[model samples]
Target: MKNSVKYAVTGALAGAANGFFGAGGGLFLVPLLAAWTKLEERKAFATSVAVILPLSAVSAIVYWFRGGLDFMTAWPYLIGGAIGGIIAGRVFQKVNMLWLRRVFGLLILYGGVRAVLLL
Candidate 1:
């Protein structure tokens, strides 16, 4: 497929999952990208991160302009997230993704439990 078609398909797939399951689809995305694209595991992951950055920034900008972002309140978490992202980026390549899948599964389970409880 052409880049445009690939992008459209990826965006559509990501959005479809987002609409149903929220951002946890990112975990789904990494593995799926690996499976779907010609990129290797590390390259696929990097590509996913590259794709996510602009999309997430645009999303945050939209929410911010729409009176959704609480910049002041979001600081502590954002700081921790940045630090964690750096650490994870360094270590993630060394870790086997079988373990990553297991960890992601736990997260999905946790989110499901939280959602059920909050309902």
Candidate 2:
């Protein structure tokens, strides 16, 4: 019951962040899932990806309906992102967890720094 509440709260927070930001829910989920569930780093990442897919689809639909999504301008990004995701998915299995964790930490750090500096 306690665990369920924790998961539900985290999931809600992740969904809200993704809905508001267009992306980034995985950032929230990764740490929470890893710590709360004691899931291995790789499994946490893979699980977060699975969880975010439906959240992203729903958010995209809402944005599209509200005239917030510009499909024409986003097509190029979508294509490149798809290619990048495919390559990363393949690479993820080969990468060591230590290196992967380091990279993830760097990215989160960079994002945090960038967000603060941009303001």
Candidate 3:
């Protein structure tokens, strides 16, 4: 029951973030899945990616229906992102978790700082 609630809340938050931001659900899910559900680091990261799929699909569909999606402009990014994802997945097991965490943290911090500065 507790686990279900945790998942439910996490899903809601992730879905909402994805729907609202077009991305970022995985960011929220990672910490929650790790801290709340006690998932291991790699497992949590993988789980976050897995969970993002459906949320992304739903968000994409809604955006498309609303005429907010521009696939032509997104194609290049999609291709590059796919390649990056493949490379990252292949290297995931080889990389040290501490280094991965550090890099991810830096990225999140950089993004946050940039967003704040932009405003």
Q: Tens-digit lDDT track for model 1 on 14-98?
A: 6555544435446656776876665676676677776766666666676789887788988998899899989999998898977
Which residue pairs of candidate 3 clash? none
Best by TM-score: 3
Off by over 4 Å in 3: none
All candidates: TM-score: 0.76, 0.90, 0.94
Task: Report how far residue 71 has shifted in candidate 3, in Å.
Answer: 1.0
User: Please, what are the lDDT tens digits per residue for candidate 2 over residues 8-77?
Assistant: 9889988998998877888889999999999988999999988998999899899999999988998999
Minimal lDDT window, size 10, model 2: 20-29
Ranking by lDDT: 3, 2, 1
Backbone clash tally for model 2? Answer: 0
As a TM-score, model 2 comes out at 0.90
Instruction: For candidate 2, list the clashing residue pairs, or say none.
Output: none
User: lDDT tens string, model 3, 27-64?
Assistant: 78989999998999889999999999889989999999
Overall local distance difference test of candidate 2: 0.90
